[model samples]
Target chain A: MTAMSSAGHSRERHALLLMLSVLAVLAILHIQQGARPIPATVMLDAVLSPDRDAFDHFVILSLRLPRASACIVGGAAFGAAGFLLQVAMRNRLAEPHVLGLNAGASLAVVLVTTYQPVVLPDILMPFAASLGAAGLFGLVLALSALGSGRFDPVRMVFFGIALSALASALVSAILILNEDTLEQLRFWLVGDAAGGGAAAVWSILPAVALGLVAGCLLMPQLATFSLGESISVALGASVHRTRIAALVVTALLCGSAVSLVGPIGFVGLMAPALWPRLHQRPSLGAFLLVAGSGAAILLAADILALGLLAPTELPTGALTGLAGAPVFIWLVARRLT
Target chain B: MTSRSADPPTRSRLTAEALSVGHGGQAVVQDIELDIFEGCMTALLGPNGSGKSTLLAGFARLLPALGGSVRLDGSDLATFPTRHVARVLGLLPQQPPVPEGLSVFDLVARGRFPHQGFFSQWSRQDEAAVGEALALAALADLADRPVETLSGGQRQRAWIAMVLAQETPLLLLDEPTTFLDAAHQVAILDLLRDLVRRHRRTVVCVLHDLNMALQYADRLVFLKEGRIRHVLTHPSQCDGRIIEEVFEMPVVSLKHPQSGLPVFLPCASRQPEARP
Candidate 1:
């Protein structure tokens, strides 16, 4: 048993290292291959030397680096939040987008852009988006709890879908009310990494860090919780307390991610949906894998968006939605059959 | 009560006094007083809607009391921290939904969470408890297997192993033998008996099979209409009158040929419409 566990541990470690290395290589390729395609050697030199050309430094430091970091952070946050929600609710369909969190954030952004555009600064967008997400999350919890005597997974999902529809309606209404803000809202709503500065990134850093730490703390209790509330309580876990903490962490992560990158859908839902099938122990390791895989998928999507339509510059969020629709269909089909 | 203070060298006992169980202001069981002795297997026997499960949940502190109190080692159960209470008492509900793709080992390892601090996530004691629980349940060979892939009996054993890994002095099980076949049921009952006898763990289980309950249980708590009809400490103490009154049927009480314990056989009423 000891030998077998040791071997399994080493294999898992090797797989994790390999995945990290792949992510690193993909990030490098993303930096080196852009519209004004710089050679790998030149990109490396520009990265190493301080006196490189202004354009090279601008592409490497100002544009590609921030975009790549945003993709990583956004994907990680969504993936972690999705995994936490699924475990807490014990439902596979519990993702921020599916649960109205993304829609809520987008609606708040739309409201700010349409009505309070002159007062709201760029750095405040993510915070506003987070509040929207948290608000919607709390609403879903309250509505579900009202309907069911206990926290039923099916009721929670239905409530989230209803909230999502309402948020979408509000967003569309705001868009129609202010035609001038439509152009700005259109780009932001579709989920783009086009114009985030160092300030925007720094603004969301604390939330992301706090969410990640809380997620790690709640992972073990989540395992117990998945066994049902009775068993969790029997195992000495305070079911209500653990579930509330999980929801709070999820809201923070999803809210921060939505604020950073406008309502990137499917990464959170799909990463967790696909992770258990790939791993042996679908507990903490599965959560980490889903987060990492979400990051990789988003980074790859951004690369495709950048490279496929070079000068046109499509929004990464639209590409993700397009790519994710068919996968969602397939998942629903698999679940049915 | 006298046996509790006399058994200083044995394990602690779990007892309830005038316990009334309810949910959301609706009382189910009322004014119950019972004692589960150390190193004994006690079975709560009742028909459906008789409040057996409600009583068990109250004993485990999963359900709040509507009236009296439950005492653990002569202390109020409500005064103990949830974690501290869990370290001494463990309860497993019937047919708990297992998480998808979780390994048996990982599921069992969660039993050690109450004993662990934030920084001390995994320890040698946790590993040992998990290993011993797996061995106890005969699931050592399938420790790494996903619970979803296990057979019904194996899955039930895996859940029992998780409860065992808690290392509690008292264990409560609500209908642990629901989905098992006869052979598996006997195996699980024998296992529980051995745990009580060898490890000095007090076990309180709710069972539907009166004959099995009579054979294995050191004490039989018979409940009817949310009230304690009678508590028989030994098989010889179980009278046919008590069984008939509680179960609403005539029964024949005879000594078992193998164990010499009293066994019950319910007789069919001689009504013309009741017959096929």
Candidate 2:
């Protein structure tokens, strides 16, 4: 028995090591590949010494640093949020984007840029987005509880889809009303870190930190809840309370990510969907694995977006959708078979 | 929240008075008054849609009582906080979905949630409870295996282990043998009996198999159409008339030669013309 337990422990340790190494490799690759990119050696030296040459400094500190940091922070938030949503709802398809949170945040941002431009300098756009996302989440929760006292997964997904379409329509209306600001909003709406400075990254740090802490605390409860509401209750968990807490955390994280990266699609859906294949449970280790995987995917996509067609600069959100769609399709097909 | 420390832990009792339970303001079970004492394994037997589960839910305080009250330790259930109630009572619903990729050990460890606080997440007591539960359920061998990958019987045992880990005085189970094979069903019933005998835990389980209930339970509460038809104390008291009345099926009760318990057999249908 001791030997068997030791073997299982070793396997878990090996998996953890592998995930950490992969994350490290992705981080290094992210720093080495970009427009006017520096070599790996120069990037490392610039990271170690901030007072390097202006060109190396620009490549390392100004350009690559913020973008990579955004990927790490934004991706971790999206992945953790996605996992929480799926576990809380007990539905594999229930990602923050699919549940209309990203759409809600995007629409709110578009509205701010169109009609409330004067308020932009005074208040951050992400805060507005968070409010919008929370509102939409509340609507979904109410709709889900319409017929059944318990939260119904199918009804919630359907309501989210409908709300997403409505949000999209509102965004389109705003863009049409303010045609002059359409070009400026268009670039931000497409999900890219092209001009996001350290300020934008810092804006979401508190939300991300709080969300991660809450998500970790709720992990054990969510694991029990995934068994079903009755079992959760029997095991001394308050299913409704746990789900609400999870939803609030998900909204905060996804809203913050969308605020920073402009509604990056598929990261939320893809991360949790992929993590279980590598790790056993959605424990803290699995959470970290999914977060790291999400960061790696986004960072890699950013690199590909920049390097694929040099000087053309395809938006990272477009690349994620383009890349995520086929991969998602493949996953579905695999499941079907 | 009343202080449970002031009261004696042993001899705890649960009773429901005119309890009506339902969802969305629609009552499914009405006027249920029953007493469940400590150290007794009570089986709630009824057909599907007979509100056996609803009654058990009411007793466990999972469903809100529409008109009456469930009293634990002679106090109204509502008087206790959720955590206090949880520490005293544990329940296992029917065929609950297992979280994918959750190991059996972690799944059972969740039973300690009521006993834990934010700072005292994983304590020695919790570990010991989990270990004892796994051993009691005969799942120590599969502790590291994901619950999703286990067989139906093993999964059911693992779930029971989770409830056992709660260390509650009262354990309520809804159809604990639903998906098991015949042998597995008997094994689970035996295990439940052992738990009641060895641990002195008060158990109320919803059962479909009348014979198993008769053999395993110290008390039998039969329900029909949400009303308590009869409560029998001994297997010999559960004869053909009670079974026929509650289940709406004609059956013959005979003594089991091996265990000397009451065993039931469904005879041929009685025609209207042969009513004599």
Candidate 3:
């Protein structure tokens, strides 16, 4: 047993290192391989000391840097959130997009941007996003609860899909009512990472940090949650409290991600799903690996979005959604078989 | 009522007062007044729908009582925080949903969750308890095997190993041997006997088999229609009549040849001499 466990431990270490290395390489590609490609020396110099006159420096600072960083950080947050949602709900299919968290954040942004006469500042988007995500999550919980506090996986999945459709309808209704903001809402709704430069991301940093802290706090609880509710409670876990805390962390992360690049799909689902292939158990280590791999996937997707179309950018969310749906379908198919 | 009874000289009791345990607002088992003595093996036996599992769940605080309270070692069960309650009592529900690809060792180690803080490092105590539990369950040989891959008997043992890893004084099991074959059932019952007799751990489990309970349990709580018919210290205290009443079947009570303990054997419901 000792020998076998030691072997598994070493395998996990190797996988972790490989994941981190991939993340680093993807991040570099994201920063250096945009349509206006900046040389490494120029990018480094711009990062270390700003030369306001240099065009490459301007592009690096004002465009690609934050976009790349947003891909990494927001992707990591989404990965953590998705992992928590899957464990808390005890359903492998559960993710922020499937659970309507991303849609909720988007709807909140739509509501704020369209309904309010005064344009909401970019700084407050994360707050509205978090509020929307948490509210939708509460509704999802209530809908699935069905008079019982128990989170039945099958019921929750149905509720998530229904809730997402309802949110989309509301978003469409607002867009129709206010036709003037149509073009701007289309970019945000499609989930663009281009203009999410430093100031915009920085404004949401507090929310991201808050979400990360929540994820860390909930990791231990979530790790034990796979033991099933009875066993979890037997091990002295307050099942309901652990559940609420997990949902809160997930909402915060999803909200933060939405605030950064609108709702990019599948980064959450694809990231953690990779760990099981590496034989990762549901633990803090697995959560970190999922977060790293999540960052990698989104960054790779962002690179494709930028480099693929040159001057005309593909929305990051569109790229992820197009690819994510197939993988999600495959996962469901495999599980059913 | 305060006496701890014949329980390895240790003092820990799970006592219930007019406990009405149920799901939603409906009580499945009502007015369950009982005391589970420390370090003893108590088996709850009853017919289907008699509420053995529900009563155990209520005692574990998974199901709220409609009216009345359960006290854990003199502390109101409701007042004890989740982790605090976990530090003392461990429960194993029937056929719990197992995570896919979880190894036996990892599953057992998770039993230490209650003792672990939100940020607690994996401690030597936790590691040792897991090792000890694996050894006790005889699953040390199959520690690396995923629980889903294990056979029915091995899987049952793996679940027991997890409960053992909790290292609590009291364990509550809901039909621990319900689905196992006859041989496997005896094996699990023997394991529970070892738990109580050797480790000084208290066990309260629901069992459908009367013979298995007779052989293993220190005491039996025979329930019928949501109420206990008898709490017997010895099998001799029960006769064929009580078995017939509870199970709704006729049986013959005879002495075990070796131990001289009473053993109930099923017999024809009608007197054999009657014409066909």
Top-DockQ structure, candidate number: 1
Report the lDDT tens digits of candidate 3 across residue range B175-255.
989889999998898888888777878899999889878777778898887887888875557788888999998789887
Q: Write model 3 residue lDDT over A169-277, tens digit each, in one string.
A: 9988889888976766777677887655788778887887787777767777776678777888888877778788888888888898887888788888888777763
Ranking by DockQ: 1, 3, 2
Candidate 2, overall lDDT?
0.79
Q: Write the per-residue lDDT of candidate 2 for residues B99-195, one digit (tens) a residue.
A: 6667788778778888987667667888889889999999998998988899999999998999999999889999999878899998898888888
Per-candidate TM-score against the hidden true structure: 0.92, 0.90, 0.93
Poorest 10 consecutive residues by lDDT, candidate 3 chain A: A276-285
Give the alpha carbon lDDT tens digit for every residue of A1-337 in model 2: 3443345447666666886787688778877776565778787777887775578777688878888898888888888887788777776667687678989888877777678756674226656787778788788778888866756766877898899889988888888888886877777688886647677898788878888898888876676666677766766677779888988888888888888887887887787666454322445666676777777778878888888898788888998889777765676566569
Model 2 TM-score relative to the real fold: 0.90
User: For this target, which candidate reaches the highest TM-score against the unseen true structure?
Assistant: 3
List DockQ, one per candidate, in order: 0.57, 0.41, 0.56
Model 3 spans > 4 angstroms off = A1-10, A115-121, A147-155, A277-280, B1-12, B269-276
The 10-residue segment with the lowest total lDDT in model 2 chain B? B1-10
Which is the better candidate, 1 or 2, if ranked by TM-score? 1
